[model samples]
Target: MSMDTRNLLVELFVEELPPKALKKIGDAFAQTLYATLQSQGLLEKDSMLTPFASPRRLGVHITNVADQADDKQVSQKLMPVSVGLDANGKATPALLKKLNALGADESAVANLKRESDGKAEALFFHSVVQGATLAEGLQKALEDTLVKLPIPKVMTYQLADGWDTVNFVRPAHGLIALYGNDIIPVSVLGLKAGTTTHGHRFEAGLDPVFIRHADTYAEQLVKEGAVIAGFAERRAEIVRQLQEAAANAGDNLKPIDDEALLDEVTGLVERPNVVIGQFEETFLDVPQECLILTMKANQKYFPLLDADGKLTNKFLIVSNIRPADASAVIGGNERVVRPRLADAKFFFDQDRKKKLESRVEGLAKVVYHNKLGTQGERIERVRAIAKAIAAKLGVDAKQVDSAAQLAKADLLTDMVGEFPELQGIMGRYYALHDGLPADVADAIEDHYKPRFAGDELPRNAVGTVVALADKLETLVGLFSIGQVPTGDKDPFALRRHALGVIRMLVEGKLAIGIDELIAAAEQPFGKITAEHRDALLNFIFDRLANTLREQGYSAQEIDAVLALRPQRLADVAERLAAVRAFAALPEAESLAAANKRVANILKKVEGEVAAKVDTSLLKEDAEAALNNTLSTVKPQADAAFDRGDYTASLQALAALKTPVDAFFDGVMVNADDTALRNNRLGLLATLHAAMNRVADISRLAS
Candidate 1:
């Protein structure tokens, strides 16, 4: 098991590649090579494979490839086609069909057999096939390897490119494929193999590099004043230079996570160098988010920080080349960033003075959709529903009203107008400027905090109220507008909004009735078609079902409780959680047997017979006793519900288990007499009424 240190050279040279695609394409190229080599069984030992790329080229060098495969037996099996044919001692047409299917030339097959099933078998014969050389085998295997390679984006130049499409990300200018010291000719896309590789476009004495092996690939490119390698190396070099420049000037710099910036910086340089630039104090007046976005989003410059956590006037700038005079680059960078910050500062001041309330009227002018009415109309519906949600939560009604009114007002603000990402943040700033209560202002901002899944939930009661109102209006409006979500498309993100409403109620411990509020919000959809109403209800509930699963509730658990009530989403969540908890108790397994027995009896007396029992007709002692106890417990259970003591209500219902089991064992529910049937049904009806206070007990899983 000797390690063969054979050098493998591979390169794809083309037009300058965008930095964004280089790292990804380089990774994909390396993976394809490893996967292909494994499939061909060429590299049996552990190997070192490294990928390198620049604006115009991507290459790889593999170190520990197997010198050669183990020599073993090559079994070849092919019988004369005439051997398995008809009884006649002849070469049949069936034999011809078999040969054609195997891609053997018809003339190549000898029409004779030696010994098969005596005389008839004797007509057929077989021949041995020779195996080819390992190098030839390797060449065939590697030739088809290019088809499996995936390039991120490609562009066509002259003749063969990566794929035969309209155009690729960049043209395949030249390629270098070498196996050890020898050239390996394998045609990929349309390009053939050679040892010639190009160097830095600007240098290298006007001649392309002629590298015999991959080990020298990187070294040759470096000598030509080009760094054709990894993103990490380039990134580290840039940071090192930037920090050095910053430290000399008594300013500390730190690297931030900006993958897009890192890539653009990679493409901006063959060799990266850095400098620090500063601006005036007036720019700090803008919001932290605005200033960060201005620097990171616009200019791709790293920000400088002071000893305090506050931002400084300086920024770190990375340049492709180290200019002889560094001040020229620094001066150029400050000029670019200053205008960006000035625009942000101007947008901040203009937005601050304009009150949120005055802009509320302009929302109606903005169309949420041509069919779904104006933003103003949507706000009116949200306002009406917010009051309902607030009342359910026992929140301050005045604050709820104010939040709904101003929530969408920031849509017209200059800050929100310029930065769509700052919608709710602007609302909070504007709310404070208007001298509104702190609770309402915080709600206006926090309502949209969790704009996506796994995002933070509302922080305050007011935010929760507005969030519910906003989701309900959307569910009702979309259903009313006949634009319900389907198998794929949910253009409105209605599902996220609905899940947000459900999650807030159950997880946030808010007690609210979903159906009642949704129906109230549906008031504005009077013009809705009947089709829309039915479809919307199903879509809304389906989204709720999905949300329930996401929150870790099982299908059986949800279905067990959902059948009882449709109005209270939060209450239903509580009931399911309690049921699951109760089910976990050791005694509950025994309790389930009694429940199953009760369920079986109830299932028998479903439709024909009434459920309420007449005390006079309770002929059996157990039936009579159970009926009396239910009468006593009914008033207490009703009282527990009024006080929101659900746990006590559940305990009260469990009291019926002994008597229910006794009644089933003693009396016959289906008797011959019509009078007896009616009497038993009446008794079961009374028992069901008591259980209904807990849940639709019939719907609870056995």
Candidate 2:
């Protein structure tokens, strides 16, 4: 370490921060501070940054930060020489005015240099700019960084004086700014720099932890404050403690893996102590998902599960303080959670008393969308769409109709009203309780499958049909009303709905075409414009192109296959595979180029070009040779295409490379003789049609 440089530390101690936004705010604080300092030349190339964030504080430690930045040689451009100086080469009023504006006087004119600025010569002023002191630079960086922090929401609170107020993520109580062992004297949010900060409201060994040095902040806080100062470190410790507690709880018992819950709990405490608590076994009769959701969402508890992944009555509590005997802590947590679990059980039991069908009428009272009527009307559309899809897929239509009718019934249940995320899940349970068919029950839940990317699709054929119908209806209905997604503002998640439709058709390998499905979905909406239908189709294809790209296919491959707008999305993968295989052949490049040329030639003809070529007009040997090659190869390619061997079909075109090159090299496609030109155009048209059956191979041309 240089004698002139030392590590710097800055911390803002405040009341509890929003746990969901704590990590993001901490990272932004450190990164922006480092960037601002680096831009001012106050940091060395080797300087390092370490961020610290807990429930109560956000801090950063930076190494090799200088007390003052280095001086810089700066150049300033004045007006053009013609405007700033007379012909006698003496100072003019404009020159003196410019010099004075730059904190200079007429004396500076003698030292000013003349330089050419591209088109004209200009007067330039040069000076050595003094560096900024640590105090000045740190103050600016602190204020700038605080403003840039991604605060979820700000709270306005009065300062100690009771007159002045400040807005911050939380009420700021203290601030610490240290350069090595000396205070740098920076302030923010009505708080002055200090070395003392409180930790672990009740468990701290010291009422105010004294940080002695910049580099010792974390260690000092841990020793005297009874707090873990690093967010990641605290989270890892909590994980370790939870694992140990779960292992000791019982055989094959493990806490549920929920990263979001873990992070939220980590932000809720400065010091973590994991303890196990259990509710009555009677609560287990309710669905485990309900129990787990209540524990994690309502109480931020980690529910433990047995070997078969079934929820046990036991759960883990991440308390902020640890006492010698934890029995009371465990008992208190148990007492607090019993009422929550009892409420869940009561909702489940009450919901099942009346059949799901009874609530179907209540859906009429719920407005789905102002333009689309009520949930009851939407259910009828979904039923119509689902029945059509079920018929196309050769599945039982009666079960699909029943499932669609009851799918949204759970939305009226008390449990679903409290937890909207459990809508489809509660429907499944209620359907099973009402003695619906097992496939119908499963389909009720599975219809909402593949809710997000990489999420699983519907489990059964019945579920698959309903899911496709549901997503399609949403897409067609919203699109009809012109609620299309533009840029990143997909308020309706139309992109996700479109991708879901693509996944079902492509992944499920259904025989249904995208157009046919959209048409079926639109049928229930009465009359939809051709414009809306076309717009929706384009949207789906655009999403499919992106999906194919994410799956690792190149843009050219996807464009070539999607160019034809293949109705059956399931055929896209096969076509792209064929295009890739055909691209690898040694003759692929030449053939692709020839195909491009052929398309351009066919596009220029004024009238329709026939695929049938007149052999009598083939006066050139190259044209005749090409014509003979197509006769022999076309049948073989057609046979392969007929049986779904796209790769073999595309590979058959390899033989035409030599003949195609010869025809394009020697033949005159647009001859002065009209008869000859039309015959050659017909030949190219035939070639274009055969080559592009799988994909537009011309797109593969470099």
lDDT per residue for candidate 1 within 1-702, as digits (tens), equals: 224447576777767877766777666666677656655455655677787767777667776555454444432234543444456644457656665675554564454434545434333324443333335444554454444446565554556443454345676677777777777666654667788877655545325777746677777676654554565577677767766765765645454546677777776566676777888987886766778767877787877665555677777887765657989888989888888888988887888787889999999999987887899988988888888778777899999989999998998987777788888887987798789989999999887756888888888988988888888788888777667777889898877877787678667866556656666677766645667766766665777777778879878666656656556665766677666765555545444565555567767764754656667787889988788888877778778766766556655666676777788789887888888777876777666666665455444445
lDDT per residue as tens, model 2, 1-702:
124999999999989999988888888989999999888888999999998899899989999999999888999999899998899988999899989888999889889899999989999999999888888889999999989999999899999998998999999888999999999888888888989888789999997988999999999888889999888899999999999999999999999999998889889989999999998998999999899999999999999999999999899999999999999999999998999999999999999899999999999999999999999999999999999989988999999999999989999999999889998999999999999999999999988878999999998988888888889889999999999999899988889888888888888898988878888999999969999999999999999999999999999999888988998899999999999999999999999888888888778777788998999999999999999999999999999988889999999999999999999889888899999988888898989988989898889889
Instruction: Judge candidate 2 against the unseen true structure and give its global Cα lDDT, from 0 to 1.
Output: 0.91
Q: What is the C-alpha RMSD of each candidate to the true structure, in Å?
A: 6.5, 1.7
Q: State each candidate's clash count.
A: 17, 0
Using lDDT as the measure, the top candidate is 2
Q: How close is candidate 2 to the true structure, as a TM-score?
A: 0.97
